[model samples]
Target: MELQTITIKREDYVSIVEINHPPANTLSSQTITELREAFQILKDDIDTHAIIVTGAGRFFVAGADIKEFTEAFGDYDAAFAMAEAGQALCDEIEQMKKPVIAAINGAALGGGLELSMACHLRLAAEDAVLGLPELNLGLIPAFGGTQRLRKLVDMPTALEMILSSKQVKGKEAAEIGLVQAAVKGDELMDTALTLANSLVAGKSMTSVKRALECVVQGADEALEHGLERERVKFAELFLTDDAKEGITAFVEKRKPDFKHQ
Candidate 1:
């Protein structure tokens, strides 16, 4: 399928996903639908071991395409559906089996930051800024921002960012655990791909996926529960073709060619 708002490319074990609804790349309803479909396609493809999500140009995504909502929001249900559908798009990335890395190369505000937060890991560029500035617009983050933000960072930090409508730099994002690494602008995609390659070659990607799932799905839970959750996934991995190939390669002390299946 052809997409004007997103670009998809796959080479070897990685898939590069880019949001390209240009001029700030606002998330229009159409863009939301397209994004959901794009994510579904990539997530269903077993050959795609990892995905690197980034924007086409400068900004990752400003937020919801307010211009599209200005007139349609005359009804409350209309507004709710818009937010809910968008949230589902982001939610799919979290549920996907493979790893997803967010290459935050520029501004990632409101829904944009929410999108990045959905990824398994985030790497921000030095110039990247992320925040939930929805309150300033007389609205709060309606697209999983309120929940996901707090889920990612501490409650206090999430509230501080939300209430103040403040934008945080890459350094601040990394320090607060919102992002794992911060690097030069040009290195954002490269860093993400490098991380993806490392996971692809480690012969423990199923373990990595298990760990990510345990933490992301654990909720306000205890370590024992989290460990148990991970244990289940780890055991389940042994049922897949990836487990057979990866474990055999490890026993042979050779590189595993993961099909991500």
Candidate 2:
């Protein structure tokens, strides 16, 4: 499919998706729609075992397009609809079955940070900076940032960052658990692809989906409920051919060939 706001390229088992809006890579409503469409195609592609989301030029995503924001949010209902759409997009990313990694190459501010937070994993260039600076615009992050950031870090740190509109560099973000790792700017995509390749190497897509579901969904539920779901998934996977092969291979002392059955 042709997409104006983003570009997609396939490499090995990974879909390299780059947010392609020029210098800033702002997320206008149309950009969000394109993102949803792009992901839909990626999700349906059987060969796409993992995905890496990055940005073109200098910014991962600067923020929402203020021009689009002012135009769409001319009234209360429009504002509500816009916020709902943005939040729903983030939620979709959070729940996506295929592993999605955000390679933050530069600034990931406001909605950009929200999008990165939704990914299953994040790897940042050492020079990258991330934050939710919506307060500076007299607004709060409407794309699940308040919730996801809280889940990712301590409440105190979340509050301090959000309230102060503070931005942190990649290394500090990794140290605080916001990103999985930090690499040099030139090596960011390579590092992300390496991580993606590792995940796809010997893992069943079904197992990957269920495992992600357990963590992402469980994060929103009570501890007991989450544990119950995890137990159910654990027992259920044993019935799959992949699981059986895994066990047989372990017993035989050979590498398992998983067909994602």
Candidate 3:
């Protein structure tokens, strides 16, 4: 399928979605809408077990297309649509059945960083920069930042990043848990693939999806729903070859070759 604003490719069970708007990859309302549609297509795709999002040129995504905010010039609908696009992208990525990983190669600021946070895992290039700079524009992140930021890191850290609007290096982002790890700029996608493929090798689609749901529902939900969810998922997986292979492989001291059943 052709996407108007982005490029999409599926390599076996791993799908790579790239932002090719060029320059700084500032996301506009149209681009956001297209990204939502692209992700929707990926969600419906059974062949793809994971989705990795990145960007072309020198940026993952610099931020929202500030032109929209300025052009809004007090038009509430403009503001509404801009925020709607950002929020929709975040929500869609979060609830996506297949795990989504953001491979940040360069700058990811404002909504760009929020986009990264919505992913189940994030891998950034060592030279990449990330921050929430909406404050400088006299605005705040409207794309689940206030909520998801605190969830990813601590409140104090999230607040410090948001309130202070200071950009941080990839290693610091990883150290603070904003991202899972930092690799060389050229090694960003390689690291992401290593992790994604490892998950594909260990679990079926059902178990993977359920695990993501459990975590996204948060720690409070984990305490209340985790065990029950895990029990149900485990029982379901038992009927699949994946479970047998997994158990037999463990007892055999060999690798479990998952079938994603």
Tell me the tens digit of each residue's lDDT in model 2 across 1-261: 579988999998999989999869998988898898888998889999999999999999999888866765558888888788888888888889889999999999999999999999999999999999999988899988999899899999999999999999999999999999999999998899999999887888879889988988998799999999999999999999999998999999999999987
Question: Residues 1-261, candidate 3, lDDT per residue (tens digit)?
Answer: 457669998777899999988678888877788899998888888888998999998999999898778898879897887787789889999898888999999999998999999898999998899999999989999987888899889999989999999899999998999999999998888888888898765567867887777667645474657777767776877888877888899999998787767
What is the lDDT of every predicted structure here? 0.84, 0.92, 0.86
Shift of residue 227 alpha carbon in model 3, Å: 3.3
- C-alpha RMSD values across all candidates: 2.4, 1.3, 2.3
Q: Which residue pairs does candidate 1 place in steric collision?
A: none
Q: Which candidate leads in lDDT?
A: 2
The best candidate in terms of TM-score? 2
Worst 10 residues of 2 by lDDT: 65-74
**What's the distance in Å from true for residue 84, model 2?**
1.0
After TM-score superposition, the amount by which residue 255's alpha carbon in candidate 1 deviates from its true location, in angstroms, is: 4.1
Question: If both were scored by TM-score, which would come out higher, candidate 2 or candidate 3?
Answer: 2
- Candidate 2: pairs in clash: none
lDDT at 205, model 1: 63
lDDT of each residue in 1-261, candidate 1, tens digit only = 567898899868799989999899888887888888888898667677788888988998888887867766568988888788878988888877788889998999988998888888899998888999889878889888888888788999999999999899999899999999999998778788989888766555666667667877786578888878878887898898888998899899998886655
